[model samples]
Target: MEEKNMFCFQCEQTAGCTGCTGNTGVCGKKADTAQLQDELTGALIGLARAVDDTSAVSKKTWQTIIEGLFTTITNVSFDNAAIEDMIQKVRAEKDSLVGDCNKCQSPCGRTDEYDMQQLWNADEDIRSLKSLILFGIRGMAAYAYHAYVLNFEDPEVNQFFCEALFRIGYAESMDELLQTVLKVGEINLKCMALLDKANTQTYGTPEPTDVTLTVEKGPFIVVTGHDLKDLQLLLEQTNGKGINIYTHGEMLPAHAYPLLKKFPHLKGNFGTAWQNQQKEFDHIPAPILYTTNCLMPPKSSYIDRVFTTEVVAFPGTVHIDEQKDFTPVIEKALELGGYKEDQTFTGINGGTQVTTGFGHSAILSHADTVIEAVKSGAIRHFFLVAGCDGAKPGRNYYTEFVKQTPSDSIVLTLACGKFRFNDLNLGEIGGLPRLMDMGQCNDAYGAIQVAIALADAFGCSVNELPLSFVLSWYEQKAVCILLTLLHLGIKNIRLGPSLPAFLSPNILNFLVENYGIAPITTPEEDIKVLLKQ
Candidate 1:
């Protein structure tokens, strides 16, 4: 096969639904940017080998691996310079551990950096399994990094990062790689739980709260992505400065945390999901600070107001560093001067306000009420219509799916996909809202907890309960979450807008035959099929 400028199919919106092999990908990643990311991944694989060889791996080495994986996630880093620097850091970490290997006359190839192209060009099934392990860890790294930012550390989670990367580079057999793939899911479950604990313990468990779509008059900033620690820091710096903060994308759930919402100026939400940001932020009079992934290339009009922090870097955007001082963002908001009058924004469904914060703790607190509702025949079924949102055409399936859910059933949603139908008032079943907004994508762990409690209450397994999972995915974070679900033996999951391009025919069939995972059909048809079960 002839070499291409670049190759990527790790996202749902990959070009032609096969691979993005051109000067740029469908996500606006340039060929040079993609090349640099692959180099960085290669360097990280080397670092993992170094860690495996040496027992003296420091805290910084683990942090480097986590940050490196997070940086390669889709829509996170597009700046070649930032990625180049990250590659250097990864190599430096490896050199620190294995410096003496350079002097050895008979150096083994074990510590050599594995070229990513080899895996990309491997057999189709091997490629599929390896991609699952690589992409799943990329997503899990984001969760681990968030937990680390809150001063939380899990040794098992950290060690698994190196172990998984080593497997990605060295494990060659189908069975060996497949075991590692499932292990990614197993480790990510604990990573997500660590993040959940870090978040709840740091900011208090989320409670149901109503966040408006209105942006009040005067200066304000829009914070997007998944990092609550960055939001907390920005909120602290902006306090008493007369500047309000509005949540966007996955940051919308931050309003449910007790410590964050206590600030009067941590006002309502601003826009819809991340995919809509280019349109929603066009010429808007505020600076947007991106704390993690889901950052689209900015339009020329709004480029100046884009400020990135942590690993979310686009060329030419201002970035906040480790000091966590948000003065630059605060100053940009002040300079924009905001609107002369208040601006009322609604979600895609045109609702003036939306309610969130039904995390696992909040939901489980009323387990008796929920079980009674289920046993008394008041609630017919539960639908978990969640995952990331993208610009792909068929994504409207999620909106239509929720719209068609029977009034007797309840809809539980998370991540940005909820933006599709979260604003619609599904009314209530018993005292619970028919549509419950579980926190962010990481909150899927909470959703699992709720499902288990419900299953235990009815003296049945989760598969036997009247529950369905209809997920729409965009990037690797969704990949990890889906793997987590599959690892738990959950069956009959309907995935859309399209199945992942990375899954080979054999692998896809395996999931279908064993796990009952299938591409979503029309909302009307799927609803009927799920209800009859």
Candidate 2:
């Protein structure tokens, strides 16, 4: 590795709104931290190559791949030692697969390793296309890992992950790279479908739920991230303990699940998005548990009270290991005593209550009503205001975009970014709430289902339908979701607060020319363009 200052501009809030080409990221990642992440990525590529054509992939191989990929996500794992250990595990798994292949003589050519630098420095267009395949797959992998932990695994989805990784390591042409990019969308569709099945099967299909903003008085714990299993586990452990659990960030959707909401103590949502955690958690008298990423480093005031479980980690915070013993978090919540009196908090829009659980099943069931509303002009336009949240100031565009949308328009949002405006009460149009929260980031799967259903009902393609996607992206998971949208040939998406640093101009041009991708301008201008289209 070159011992120069580090440079990374893959997210929306890059340093100085350009790129973080310095000793640390604008988000606080250090130089050594960036290199270790690179090393881990390199090792993961190697592991993928090692399994290139193997007849069988063991549980250990899949586990190593999932953990390794998760570790490279923006703020998940920062410890060099942990990443190094993961790299060793990848190498060991590769060696075992290699040894098995040596005896067969008929090399399956299935497993092999990749060096990610080729992607970092490829021709601009090829790099952009490949980056889409690579980063998009990375985001999709997080959802797959989450679903897998809940005992739901799709073989085709898993196999495509390995295949995509293998191509990223060796693919050499624009056409090949472009094909890989679409394949990512195809595979992610299955991955998202698998997660949907897992979530619905494990925790019944979500019904329309009215979640309150008031957190009951008592010992309470706030759980964040998109892992339903962690939420279920915490709910199980905290049951009957006089502790109320509140969903935060991506955990907001847990409220809609019948199995999860059955717990009376499982109360409503706490804060807004993950980016607001530091300010939101300050002086809060409860333990905050992070089941997954988008965790910013905690301040000392709430640092001791913050606990991480599963793959999420921060150096000084306490971690709840595999045993799922949340006793420490529970003890901390009790010690904090919470609020002596019941407290009422309002959402961003001053709405006392927000509704969720309008997933694919629920939305599709109402397709006829929705189609009629559009035909009758009760619903003028549909806007999908969704994607990741970041520290960029321009992100306020989402809030303004939703705020300025016509009352006749419906705003459908997904992911943590929606927290910015999910609290806003846009009122209703034609009996449907003007704004709908479609679960966590993975619930983009649900949003896609709603889009396709609407398209079918209206006898038009998804793009020809009166729907516009105005998205805000911050991490790799968003990358995958965007790729999926592109794969389906959906066009005219306005993305912001900033575009990914990984996309070269040529690749961006391809997206612009082919998919009509554009950076978000002013909310006023974007709304006008969207309405005109």
Candidate 3:
């Protein structure tokens, strides 16, 4: 038997392994735990395969696939029992598809469970390419799942999700894998657009919302993650009960939307990035709610008060079903009684309030001002300092990166990672705040729109503009966003805390040669290189 250090390192906090190959992750995933996750993924692939044709996809199939994939995300579901239940659902869906296939006697040969190990341990180049495909699809699935919960579903996005999963299960060869990688980007673009539409249409375009870090006294719930619908439901259930709701992590954007912000009891933000949850939620005098991913296992001090809705699940935490009844969570918040007096918390940068909702619509509406500033040399460059945050000490590079950017430049940031510096009062340039918060991770769509609009206004390709991407990636969402940038032919992107463990040298070389993607160095050196460009 091969002796191994706990083989798990797919996250910012990997154990000794570059990509956790052993019986447990450094984060505490047991070997059997890892195997169940793989099995759940395989079952999802089987369900995807069963939907080889469009006719085979039902609402049930899409829900199962999305939930199954979400369950496999790091820290979301660690329970073997939950994973087994999901596997059974996937099998049942596959069975239904087989029944239909048998009646028609049409063997598509498309439905089959993929051995995830094939992608994990393939030839380096093929593994990198396939990893991009699989990870991108997983990230895109999260967005689609959010839209699904709001009763808004996109047929093209849903069908392509299944198609992508099917290919991941069956495709072979580096060339084939490379195509699948780019296709993930293409489909993710549509999926993001669909989500943007769903979010805006449902909640109205996010505006410039200045959310305070001050937690109002009385019972409150701190809701975290990317699900606006879940937050809205909580707000609704807690309304008039004197229980205040606070947004946390990606849910911070919920404070900016008109539909959601209308809740009188929806107070302000709580805590910073997801990684800080263990400390931030310690002995918190409120019931905390997790609506999506980036959930660390709760410490015992606060575990009893944590509530999960949607796809987020941690064993022993209460799970809210589709009805969205948040009574139990509300009851917990009231029981905790919160702080005796209003307590003020600050962002990592010590700013009392962080501003968000400057999405594409908000930014583009001021296009004339931005264009004039550029023409007048008031704005010399645009820097998109965005991506996921990790536990690496080097992540301080971002804070330093934003700090060192030339005063004449504008910084556009998105994702929870931006919480590192978004609260800093970088002030403004030419009537625009130096750093613009462009909503959540999915709001990378907003950043892309702003770029395209700027390109159009200047009558040049987006690449021709003086814009540079300094991204920090920690998960599959970042994977899909990077692929989108590549799909757009955008170049000269600086990525860190580290290049993905899945990116082989050959594939990395391909990206370097074609897209000029490079690992981030020191902020001082990166600023010099970006300014030189």
> For every model shown, what is its TM-score relative to the native structure?
0.99, 0.95, 0.95
**CA displacement after TM-score superposition, residue 157 of candidate 2 (Å):** 1.4
What ranking of all candidate models by lDDT puts the best one first? 1, 2, 3
The list of candidate 2 runs beyond 4 A from truth reads: 1-3, 16-18, 100-115
- Model 1 scores a C-alpha lDDT of 0.93
User: What C-alpha lDDT values do all the predictions have?
Assistant: 0.93, 0.84, 0.83
Model 2 Cα displacement at 16 (Å)? Answer: 4.3
Summarize candidate 3's per-residue lDDT along 59-82 as a digit string, tens digits. 888888888877777767777777
Q: Candidates 1 and 3: which is better by TM-score?
A: 1
lDDT per residue (tens digit) for residues 173-279 in model 1: 88898888888889889999999999999999999999999999999999999999999999999999999999999999999999998899999998999999999
Candidate no. 1 TM-score: 0.99
Model 2: per-residue Cα lDDT over 379-457, one tens digit each: 9999999988876788888999999999899899888888778878788876788888888889998999888888887
Pick by lDDT: which candidate is best?
1
